[model samples]
Target: VQGSFKADIKLEDFVNNSAAVVQTINTWVEDRTNNLIQNLLSQNDVTRDTRLIIINCIYFKGTWRKQFEERSTNENADFHEASGNVSKVKLMFTKEKYLYGENKDLRVQIAHLPYKSDNTHVQFVFTVILPEKGVSLDSVEQKLSSKPQLLQQILNDGYTRTEELLLYLPKFKMEASFELSDVLKKLGMVNAFSDSAADFTGIVSKKDDPAGLYVSKVIHKAFIDVNEKGSEAAATTAIRLTKRRRLASDIKLVEFKVDRPFIFMIRESHNNITFFSGKFLSVPLSYYKRALRKIDVIFLDELGSEAAAATAVIMATKSISFRPKPSPIEFKADRPFLFYIRETRQNLTLFTGKFLTPTNFS
Candidate 1:
């Protein structure tokens, strides 16, 4: 989704004021999304001096331009990926000159539309699958013979056609966040965020001798819903910056596979960067459905017995790990704590419920 806008503001000045940052974000969203989306959170929440700022938002609105008509959509269309499994998906067939592009190897069409406002932008990328089935990702590199040409074609080529058919797609929503550090680091952008990263010297006036500080956290959320009626989705990204002259370190992606039921905590020491992580429990899904989920406590007394077990386990685990020794001894049997829990086809009360006193359980 995207909208149209024209303005130029200094990045440093925008970073200093929370309101400015939010307004800029809103503008970016509107422009990028082509006005298909809107900013829900007020601008004051995101500020320069603030160590951590939360950007909570949702996009329940519909699309400004419907690319695929209901009559031309094909229901039960098989979306066969590189894998052997075939997923029944709605086939939106359009010969329209979307942001169309192609080369000797690949044909990628990008559909640009408004998101309702100017805070973010999204492009619908339609890539033609060269290989019919059994996709080999390793071979994909060889397939894109001319990426530049393909990009150019998508930007300036193609035709438009509409028809009558059925389209059926499952609704989906995802909430996620990224530490700006990780994003920058991924882009080979460590130099701009390091201790000696002189590029940021202009962020403040002289005389304010800065010490050790780096980006502390990132938070994000995305939602998508589709049913017999239609489909709508949106995502929000937030960054938390800390003031310190810190060095960029190697990113160690610890793969905590939640194959079995286990409890973990997110605190200052564990380096747990994610929050509110979770998995979906389809009928066949076991603990193996997803890798890990970040947990937080809510409604302790009313959480019943399950919440108590998760709390105890998290308390016991956090106390022994980080620097200065977090005092898990303070964790009471009644109060709730935070920890990831694995669900199953059967009952998943692996380590919870015993802590509740006898004859007093709810």
Candidate 2:
């Protein structure tokens, strides 16, 4: 059985070190990763303890508003980096009001869209450098560094409100978990995680006793989605610990420049339904649609599932077979048939009556 969720501290040193205590923890957890999870658990805290150890973990997910169909991504595309190297990357494209710019001299159009905010708060910006008749990204970043706003000037004046844009991005998602004890030690605060280290006066100090300020578990999870129209990223980082007491503080910002292909997903926390799904597999739409039709909607993975459907009906989850041999008309067009869809965690009502009357399905 899953236990109740709570943040309990010894409460003795909770007042003094509250400020630094929270800041240190935030830095420790946030510095571990540079991804999209930060956007999810932006304003969060991890509590410490003496006897009971609290472990907090979160799952973050997201997807693009306007999907870049799988087949749109093709090979023979150039991906330029800050190091003056161009890799062969599969570019995904779409025509929309995207963040775009064109460097006439370099002959490239770069569109940048920040990814969704998650726990680790990472922004995935992509620049599609459409090289001119003979230009390439190889000389672009270098020229920008020398001239500074060469790219900026283009971005400022080159931003056009075009509805249809040829967009190309690789879909991807990253999952990582790290235990940050030694990492914290490297960040300059050493006494906090030791047995003989003195003075936790800021957080809970019991008569000069050094039994406080030992971090047990620092778990951070992140997720991000970026495609056509804008991007979304989110995450939840929990510091489940013991021998401690501290108050939480402000959050920091981190950016992840995504210039390659990656996979991503959008998961519903409350209902666990994946409303919109995107893959960077470069497969046909019909393949995914047909596969999706056979898979259970409630719990779908990259593979498949034998998930069970709901039984009790009180809303829109009804089947022609679920009725009966001339079932009683407890719910007519005046009332309506009510069934439940476990996947979306919603109570849907199928009705054919007055809007006013259909709403009173108590």
Candidate 3:
């Protein structure tokens, strides 16, 4: 609680000046999140019955160790969805050395991309878990849910090797908001949400006054942007006590193309803590079918047979010689996938999301 701050707002003022109070809270959220999130709470969110409001915000900005070249990003790359739909997306490409692993048992390919950190003791990484082409992301999620240790194994035991790879990842931005009272209730924390059963003697002494306290609503909002440079993410959570609610590789390397839907996470390398995790399912209404470029073929109809034959021979001789290069192993994630952001030393997940679609495209 060293960095924690507390403030008291009169209930009368909160109810009378609801808009101002909401603006004050939103201003704090915007400041904490570098303006990435705004209007976190509205008039309907706060009420006179609300005894207390607690909020937490986290913001992160990290640059890639070896960034993707802006010019190398393909503006119209094809992303294949799980439903067999295709969308045009901004795809990033790079060939560099990176920590990588493959788990046959899990049927997944893992790649670790480290971020540049000023603190030597702190190392942040973006990890992508791409299921084998035929494997469904749901299956992988089910397996990880069933045996959480498998995720640890995937992070610790599986990624010991480094390889050069051709990587393709999409540039995406996502903003998500969730009302988590029901989710928390389902997790078996019912008493806190129950007005009759909730005990708030610790927060509000019964001797002082006894309407008691229960969580009314729990809302969480998050935002993230991943591009050629690195990533910027912000998240905020507000708990109203009025209710018992909660609220890249190089030459000859393997190819790791995230052209499909997959799983991704950002973590601190030292403590193996996951900060954010989510799946990129699909790119909303941003689907585009690239129009085939029309090529005009001119025939030498006016040329004599002998002349045409001679021209054909000359053209054949002058044709550019194409050599077949060795194809690196391709790890294209053309479908949906997941991503996470975390702090290393404390082993805390900062952000988790899925980039199903591109929010911005040129």
Candidate 4:
């Protein structure tokens, strides 16, 4: 029941002082996320019609139980891209005992790296899911999407043993932002976003207004940084009420080199709550150089009414765009992979994303 709610701003301000409103909301977002997430809202995202907004923000920073040696990191390590290209990246190396497992069914090597936590009830672990070399990550994604329980099964049954491992994980930083109204609609959540069908009478008394209220937009932004010391991540989600709409393991010196694309997640050990989950499909710009050589742009315009003569104009332009080995116990992630953070007790996912190419390298 504990929460933070703000209702002082008037709907008129959303129209007349949108900039100020946006700044207020964004500032709150930035502060809550330790400045890791900023500008969660723009003026265009708010209007006079907007009646309410709900926001949630989370920030996490964890040190590895056994930190990587700063000097052991390789700055020029070659990371294999899914596109068959290679890029030089900063990869951190460590030798440590970690929880590890392999799911032959999923064709992935799993590694579990625990974070330093003083509270026993709040344990967190970072998990990496690396698909076997030459396996398409898309296929794995489809299976996971089709069967959500498969992920839980992987975490519970796949990683059953502890092993001493030589780990090579990339030093990376990434940020992502998404607008989810359409996505929600496509997921069968339609009534809340329909201007005419939305029902928010419980949230607001709409007896006097025929238009009532509906969701207009949902915005989400996230950031994460992984380095020798540990991991830092933050995410913010805002729901605008304006409209109705809306690791592996290994043991035995078994090599688990993650030199290709894979999936990952962070979660709480006890509850299996995943905080973050994403895939990293690292593709170097050079991989797309050939495609970038040619560029095409197409524009179409329709003129005239239904009863009148129809005229169409078409314009075209062209634009173009575009591992490792190891010991049996080694788990080197030199390619794209997915990762996430989660709370063990509550089984809540905190932050997750793919480690494609390192932002700096890209």
Candidate 4 regions with alpha-carbon error over 4 angstroms: 1-12, 208-210, 235-252, 283-328
User: For model 1, what is the error of residue 132's alpha carbon versus the real structure, in angstroms, after optimal superposition?
Assistant: 5.7
The global C-alpha lDDT for each of the candidates, from Candidate 1 onward, is 0.24, 0.29, 0.60, 0.61
How many steric overlaps does candidate 4 have? 63
Task: Give the TM-score comparing model 1 with the true structure, all chains together.
Answer: 0.36
Model 3, position 344: C-alpha lDDT score: 53
Worst 10 residues of 3 by lDDT: 305-314
Candidate 1 ranges beyond 4 A from true positions: 1-77, 88-103, 107-149, 158-177, 196-199, 218-221, 224-231, 235-362
Cα error of candidate 1 at position 76, Å: 5.7
The parts of candidate 2 lying over 4 Å away from their true place are 1-60, 75-91, 101-165, 207-210, 223-362
- The model with the greater lDDT, 1 or 3, is 3
Better of 1 and 4 by TM-score: 4
lDDT of 2 by residue, 63-179 (tens): 333445555544345543333344443344444455433334544443333223353323222222333323333344455456654433433313422223433443222122234
Cα lDDT of model 3 by residue, 1-362, tens digit: 33455633344355577678778777877787677666677677776666566666666676788888888888888887777778877788877777677776667777777778788778777777877777777887887777656677667623445556687888776555566788889989787777777776786777664577777777666656677777766511121111011111222435777777877676776777876666776775422331121110000000100000000000000001333343444555566766655445544454555545444434
Can you give the lDDT of residue 155 in candidate 3? 72
Cand. 4 TM to true fold: 0.78
User: What are the per-residue Cα lDDT tens digits for candidate 4 across 1-362?
Assistant: 13445423334355578788778776776676666666677667776676667666666666777777778878778888778878777777877778777666667677877777899888777778877777767777776777666777666623456666878777665555567788889999887777767777775565655457777777766666566666676612121111000022331355566566766566777787876666667743432232211111000001100000001111111110111232446888887777766666666665555656544433
